[model samples]
Target chain A: MFDLQGYGPSLLAGASMTIAVGLSAMVMACILGLVGAWAKLSASYTARATAAVYTTVIRGTPELILLLLLYYGVPTLVQDLASLAGYEIILNFNPFLAGAVTLGLIYGAFATEVFRGAFEAIPRGQTEAAQALGMSRFRVAVHITLPQAMRIALPGLGNVWMILIKATALVSIIQLDEVMRKAKIAAGATHQPFTFYLLASFIFLGITLISSLVQRQLEKKAHRGVGQA
Target chain B: MNFTTMLEYLPQMLDGAWLSLQITGLSLFLGFLLAIPVSLMRLSHLAALRLPAQLYMFYFRGTPLLVQLFLIYYGSGQFRHELEQIGLWAFFRDAWFCAVFALTLNACAYTAEIFRGAILAVPKSDIQAGKAFGMSGLLLFRRIIFPKALRIALPSYGNEVIFLLQASSLVSIITLMDLTGVASRLVAKTFAVYEIYILTAAIYIAITYMLVVIFKLFERILNKHLRTDS
Candidate 1:
């Protein structure tokens, strides 16, 4: 009575949606993490303070709350801004978009710490060597600091990616039609909650398994030259 | 913009927050209890004990908690006669029991890993010293290994507590009137979804902030020996 043929398409669609959301959110988190690290490490006191507050507040709130708030609150916020600017505009919010942004913001706080630690691990001698080679400060950073820092940060970033993948499952609660939601619908329709749920968990396990393999490859590549030294 | 309106619904929200706190607390206690034995089993050299513990962690950690809750709460209904024969259908029928059971199982897996890591982290030198002092088994664990592992595990365990608190929001989906359930209900009744979500999120932020401060204090006291200036 378990009709995989009938539900196969929807379940696959859900898995792809989960991946799309997870990848988009990863890009957003990376951008936010970069900026957060910069602000935290900046010479300006206010920049440091602003980054501190951002990370602190984001860390203290649950991602579910953030997702719900953005999914519903974004349009209102846009409307208020438009009215204040003497224009009338309507904005439609998608749960996928809201979920990605919410997850991005929630995990960015953690990424900020990881990036900060990585950046701090970069030795002053390397930058000095880059400067001695007549490379400008910006060029040195682009050519030397970033590559090395990212290498150091790979393991931590991989851990975050795992967390992000699991966190994406929560998006289903907001009716995002991701894997978990897909599984729920199938369960309800077939009256086989255990079967559907177990299938969904297996799919997720497959994802995390493949992800761990890819992460191991990345870490090995990142550490290519270091083992000799 | 709807701050004043949200204020009008504050009492109900507060009650929901209290319920959330209770569920989180009770589940954490239950999970910690379950975690201790499972962690020991996981650390055991015996294959029989270790394989099942490994499977427990593998399934719980890999799956979504929402699905787990649904499977137990709704799926249990599918086996009403079987569960009734075992006298468990009565317990499984309640949303709170289902929520707590799912949360506790999930947390047990995570907390087991945390403790396993802490146990491994306990200095080998100290363990050897305990043996040298003529202590073994329970005496050694009680006098040395348990204390050190607990201290090592405290910070990560604190993060687990925060995670559990956040995860309890999922209970609302199962018909339990937690903070998120209240927010969702109010959103339905008044169509003030945005305002209610903001209020709910703010309450969570306050609770999380308090938890972090308390954990920091605990860490300070426990780690006094390592304090550079102390």
Candidate 2:
């Protein structure tokens, strides 16, 4: 057995931090995704245009750059605005919050596309029928649109989750105590970069492997009684 | 807001942009070339070939590229004596080599999967047609399979190339002066963090847009014969 030099506990802690950051970011991404999908589907020109621009700009740029901008740039911007108002203020974004929010913003653009596609794939007739039956728009969304769209969006959302988890590794650049950062510390201390990085990769591979299995189960449950005899 | 500072940094940023393109272009070309054989191995009937191919894809596709880069770059230092004895330490010592090496390995895994899917999607009827015409082996592949699979894989391959381009930014972490690296350095010197990064983001966006446009044009050219215009 390879010697971890008692760094095993810290690595485990770091792995949990990675998962926590990823889940929190997933929550943020899901909220933005829903609002984005709503905006894209809305009748107003401004809402649609704003959502379009958001997805386009975010999707076109690199995630690391966005993370860096949020980490380094935002604080300066906040301070500059404060100074312009003749009130001095220092703003240092918590690294954990910055990492989660940056990942959320980057992945939310992708989730928006997934949700929009899922929403559009729902047949128009069902919504119209619900409306005709005196169901409110909210009621129609809840009873008709949401369920079917969830079934379709599940696969894409699963994909977003996978990518988002991997992107959490980038948070290590901001000095977050995620698995990658912890592994780097262990590697440096042990002079065993290969061993530690290899283990880190395995941790990520393990997450994806488990997530995919759970996703399959979710997809099956979502499709229950519909595609089978 | 500081137009003067941004203007001064523009040349350095553009130089970094060129280097980024170089790394991306070199890796994509090599990776794609390697992927053909890897994809073929993945599709092979033999368990030996397919098993290794599957593991390679799983490892590369499952892990984050940053880890892979670190493993290749810093990890090699752990075996410096072995590497030096083998006369390969020089290559591993160079950050540029490690960056490209890792990126190419990653690109190969992803591009192989794309090719595998595209190859699978090539119509069975078309392959059968080639067989009926006495085509076999390389002849069949060149005349029938390659062209069709290229068309099918073009879109995903384009996305892969963009991913590689974006992934190339990671090289900056290893101390290479790619676009992101130069931007970070500029930020450190000028303290104009937002201005430098926003400008960098704009450059990345432009390159992404250009790649998309190029891929779309390529797709149009590939499908031109399928057009039914009178």
Candidate 3:
């Protein structure tokens, strides 16, 4: 039973940072997901193959490894290239940026699957109907395909967001003072590992519960007009 | 760039991989075994049994696995004196046991959910038919509920198993020299993070591919009876 006296503000700040990272990474993932899904569903073999490889490589590699590679490996590679070109490297890799990008890339793979499924779920007849009405393919996609695909994609996308939220704790390993890292520091200061860690767990559980409620609301709103099948 | 460097490190990586396999395999086997009972408890009428199982799943699944691993490994170390007094220190003293324990608990939480979902998805008609045939209790479950639920659960459980394999890499933090741990060590020594990490990623992808194949085969076998009956 560790008292929350000295550690409350620090943990709260960490929670805010975790949420910021999760949200930013999620936005990046969404952008990547849509593009990757579109590429995957493209008629061109090369586009599909490239998308498949991206998804496979991202999903197959562990997030920790990706974080390490991007944080440590990428910076070194960039510096080497800069040296080769006889220029100083200006952009250094920060841990937060590294973590966010890695998380975004990892979840983007999952998001692609969700988006692809959603895109495929749209009725083919609607596209045909739009085309018959003299709409261009681009117009059909804009007016018909994208909206329906988004609605269908909402639940799965929400699930990925939840996963990404939890996965942000791994960024603590890179010395980012997120919730888990702050908890570790507090535990060390107080010499109460169980109490601090349990408190951190409660914070995570709270995040999960609150986000789940939000996701449920979003799903409901997304499905407002769509009749239950 | 050369085969010789790879061959030289082969034995070390293989040893690391063996430990990983052992941890993943044993934990998965034990976790699945534990899941059956926990899932049953979840579906049980008794609140005493169901509440605990539900809470276990919620807490375990809600938190990140890394945090859970650190909490168990480092947090348990905080209780070393008490554990030593109780003669339980031997188990907690070994990093292998600690890793296995954390992984087993994590997998149990996930597998229980999968099993519970599959059990719920078992059609009412099947249970009714079993009842009509005079099957009851253990006999009914063994003959009807268990097998069908397993069939439904297999695909999701296979995915969970793959997740467990990947999750095992996190145990390297607790001083278990698994593949990722070895890779980290190699990177530290050789300063070639990219090559070592790429090698580790390749190994993981290869293992994941094999697991996918095995799972597909298992799913095929599970569906064999359903196919014939249909």
Candidate 4:
């Protein structure tokens, strides 16, 4: 029961930044996931190859490496172009943007597999019936396929969300002021590493508990109309 | 890329890769050894054993590995004077030891869960059959439970191994000059960030692909016994 005097606001602000990164990354991942899943499931060889490479490369690399690659790596490339153009480059890439995008890219690769599995689980007969009724492929997918696939994807997606939420902590390495970064600063300032680290753990645990409950609710809603048999 | 440049960096990259592999291999080995007992504890009938095992899993799995690494590395460093007095500072003083310790603990939690699932998935009838044949306790576990659990666990354990390999890159933060660390240092020196990172990514991809092949071979070997039984 160690008290962190006057540190509450800093920790809360860090938590908010963490949440923002997680939320934005989740949205980006979802979009990329859907596209990657479609490419993977597509009949075109090039599309399938592209999708395979995306998942393999992203999944193979560590998230931190990807973060540094984007953070330090991309800025150099951008500055090189700026110098070539004879324009004064004033654009500084924020660590937060680099971190969120990197996490989104990495998580999206895993999400692609989850989505592809979910999409594959959908019965072909449902699409056939829609086609037989004169519905176009687009309409059939929109009206019949996606909604059902989402149900199967819900549990796996929930797990990915948890991983993403925890991963936001890694942004601290690149100097983003997330909870872990703030805790590190506080610990350094106050010379109480155990208290601040434990407090950070509690905040993370709290987020995990709340989000897990929300995931269960979403799973329920996603599975609502389906028969359990 | 010129052959001269590649040759110059080859030895350095190879040394880094060796360290990465050593870290991952040692952690995976130790993690699996620890996981077996933890998984058994989790499956135990006694609440006293199960509660602590469950708490261990919950806390380790719930937190990010990076935080755990920091907690062990820097947090432990906060008590360096006391650790020195106890004669344990020598071990914790090394970044390699700290990295391996944290990674092993992290992997143990996840692998234990995988093992628990595999152990439970072993058919109850199989155990009863072993008991019927006068097998009991350790004998029954050895003859029946273990083989079945290993079969079920191997695939997921393979994934965890790959994860640990990837995760070994995080050791760079604690000042271990692994592949990622080398790549970052090269970037800082040459300002050729894209080339270095792309090369590092390629190295990881190659290692990961090899692991996938090795796991597939393991799965094939494990399945051979099952096929004969069938």
Candidate 5:
């Protein structure tokens, strides 16, 4: 029966920021994943090697290390580059931006695997037939490969989104005013840790449930005609 | 950039590495032990046992482990009087104990699911054979089902072990001087954030690489029939 009256507004505001951060990171992760998968699947040996190493290195390391390095080092990295270019300017890294980019970068590794599997799932014959029909490579990819890959990758991407949402909790360590951070602040101030945290947990649970529902609907839509077949 | 500063702090980083390994080792061991019973409960026909296991797994897997750590570490302070009444306040007071507690709970949830999946993967025909050979209940489980399940579970469980290693990094947030904690302290002292992180990441890569090698060899030996020359 612990009332959230006093701190409810801030918690909601924090949840909003959490969603924004999660979405922004999800977008970046999708972009990185697509590019990584493309490189890994491409004809160039160097491109494939670079993509393989990036995914391997990122997947093996913990996300916290990456977050801390980016948070504390990005500013220095910028300052150093600026000085080298003859401008000695001071720089500050935005916590939200840092959090999103880091999460995107980390999960990009997993997503590459997902997309790679999706790409592999598409039979080569489909592309061959498309090419036999005099379709351009762009047309073949867009019309035949991309849609089916999206259908197959959607479930995996949904899983990545789940992990991404949970990862937003880590950004609180960098002092981003996301839901976890706000809950921590309120818990410390009120000495009602369970109340705030439990509520925050429920909020996270609600988001997860909704996202799962959305994922289900998307899956149904993606498989509309194929499932009947 | 400052190699000397990093080299000077290498000892602290190593100390942190020891603590990290100890925590991950201890927690995953306890968690693995807990996982067996919890997963069995999840597989139970009785709603009473099954429901609790389901809810526990759902909550733990659904939420982030970091918040779980925060709740156990900081949340317990709010109930000191109750904990003191139960004579458990002393345990909750230590950050190390809280970190281990939270990590074990989170790991148990994941490992339990892995166990459950492996249990389901056990061929029913094999169990029927066990029963036909005059085995039943606990005897059947100990002789046949458990062994097969463990074998089936090994690869995924190896991934879980590596994940537990990664998750152990969060203990640094609870004020425990595990690897990440010590590295952060060094960063504060020397302002050599990038170098220290790169060095620490290298150690993690080394550990994870070693684990992958170990697991691959173990799996090969465990499932001799499944091995193929690549």
Candidate 6:
């Protein structure tokens, strides 16, 4: 029964912020990931090359550094460009927007791989069979390819979600009022750093546990009507 | 695009990178040593032995490393009296010690799981053969199981090493002047955000590339006998 020192409400608020940032970023990541996967698998050489460059650069760098760069570097670069254009507009990034976009971009590299693998796993015959049935490419993707790929992509996407949720804690460095930042403030105020931090860790663990359970359910539904054998 | 600032900060960032390498090397070695016992516990048939190991792995793996670092670095202050009474506060008080301690424990959890999987994948046939040759217990493990498992685990273990290196960036938050820490400091001081951070990212990419090469060579050596060309 460790006392939260009346900061329980703020911590809960912070947890909600963390989830908000994570979900919004995940949505962005999914969009970019889909596009990146499509680019990599496209017939266009330039598209594949650009996607390759994007994923490689993002994947090779540390997430923290990437986040910091976007948080600090982008606004500076934009301001300089604005100066060159003769407009003296000062620019500052909103922490939530920058954090979400950067996190999405960083993890989208990983999600690119996940989606690519999933797309590849879908049988070519399935696509050809849809074509034989005179289905449009969009219809084939929507009906045949996407359904199958989602089933395959579920596990990998689940993995990306777990890592991304944990990564939301790093947004605290950029001054987002997430759970980690809230815990820091509470701990500093109360001087019970261990208690608050341990509480934060448990919150993360709870999220992970619940996500995995949800993933299992999703996997089961995704696999429904298919033979167990 | 100031070349002068980039040149001036390069050496400081390199020094910070050296510290990052030191932290990664020390924690990785210590974590691997700790992982062996943890992995063995994970493999043990008894729930008493397995359950605690599973929990340890679960807790460390599930939480972000930043929380772990804070829980060790800042959190130790909460237990100052108890830790002092036990004479462990001295070590816990040092930022470097806490950084290494947290990173080691975090790495240990992931490495333990990797080792557990690799150890389980070691063929029963190989163990039985070792037993038939009068090998048992430590001898069996040393001669047959470990070497094979080392091969199985190398790829994932190499990945853990890279992850640990990247994860070491979190030590910056705890006031350690690692690569990321130094870059942040330079950014604050010079306001040459793009120049310094870009250079730092390049340095990290180079280090990651080198590690990949080194791991590839190590893997080749470990699996040398499996080569068909010979």
| Model 6: per-residue Cα lDDT over A1-229, one tens digit each | 3799899999989999999999999999999999999999999999999999998788778989999889889889888788889988777888899889988998899899999999999989999999999999999999999888888999999999999999999999999999999999999999999999999999999989999999999999989997691
Per-residue lDDT tens digits of candidate 4, residues B1-230?
A: 22345446656776888889999999999999999999999999999999999999988888888888888887887788999999999988888999999999999999999999999999999998999999999988888998899999999999999888988998988899998888777768766777778778888889999999999998998798567555
Each model's TM-score, in the order given? 0.95, 0.99, 0.95, 0.95, 0.97, 0.97
Worst lDDT run of 10 residues, candidate 5 chain B, spans B1-10
Proportion of native contacts in model 6? 0.89
lDDT of each: 0.88, 0.94, 0.87, 0.88, 0.91, 0.93
Pairs with backbone N, CA or C atoms under 3 Å apart (clashes), candidate 6: none
Candidate 4 lDDT tens digits, A1-229: 3778778789889999999999989988988999999999999999999999999889988887788888877877777788888876755678888888988899999899999999999888889999999999899889898888888898889899999999999899989999999999988988877678878887888889899999888887777767682
Chain B TM-score (model 4 vs. true structure): 0.95
CA displacement after TM-score superposition, residue A78 of candidate 1 (Å): 2.5
Distance from true location, Cα of B172 in model 6, Å = 0.9
Q: Which ten residues in a row have the lowest lDDT in candidate 1 chain B?
A: B190-199
Per-residue lDDT tens digits for candidate 3, residues A1-229, read 6686599899989999889889889999999999999999999999999999999888777787788888887877777678888988865677788888999999999999999999998878999999999999999989899988999999899889988999999899899889999999988988877777888888899999999999888888888877893
Total clashing pairs for each candidate: 0, 0, 0, 0, 0, 0
Candidate 5 lDDT tens digits, B26-136? 999999999999999999999999999999999998898888988898888888999999999999999999999999999899999999999999999999999999999
Question: What TM-score should be assigned to candidate 1?
Answer: 0.95
lDDT of 6 by residue, B24-60 (tens): 9999999999999999999899999999999999999
Better of 2 and 4 by DockQ: 2
Clashing pairs in 2: none
Candidate 4 structure, TM-score to reference: 0.95
TM-score of 6: 0.97
Interface RMSD (Cα, Å) for model 4: 1.6
Stronger candidate by TM-score (2 vs 4): 2
Candidate 2 regions with alpha-carbon error over 4 angstroms:
none
Give a tens-digit lDDT track for model 1, residues B81-117.
8899999999999999999999999999999999999
**Which 10-residue window of candidate 3 chain B scores lowest in summed lDDT?**
B1-10
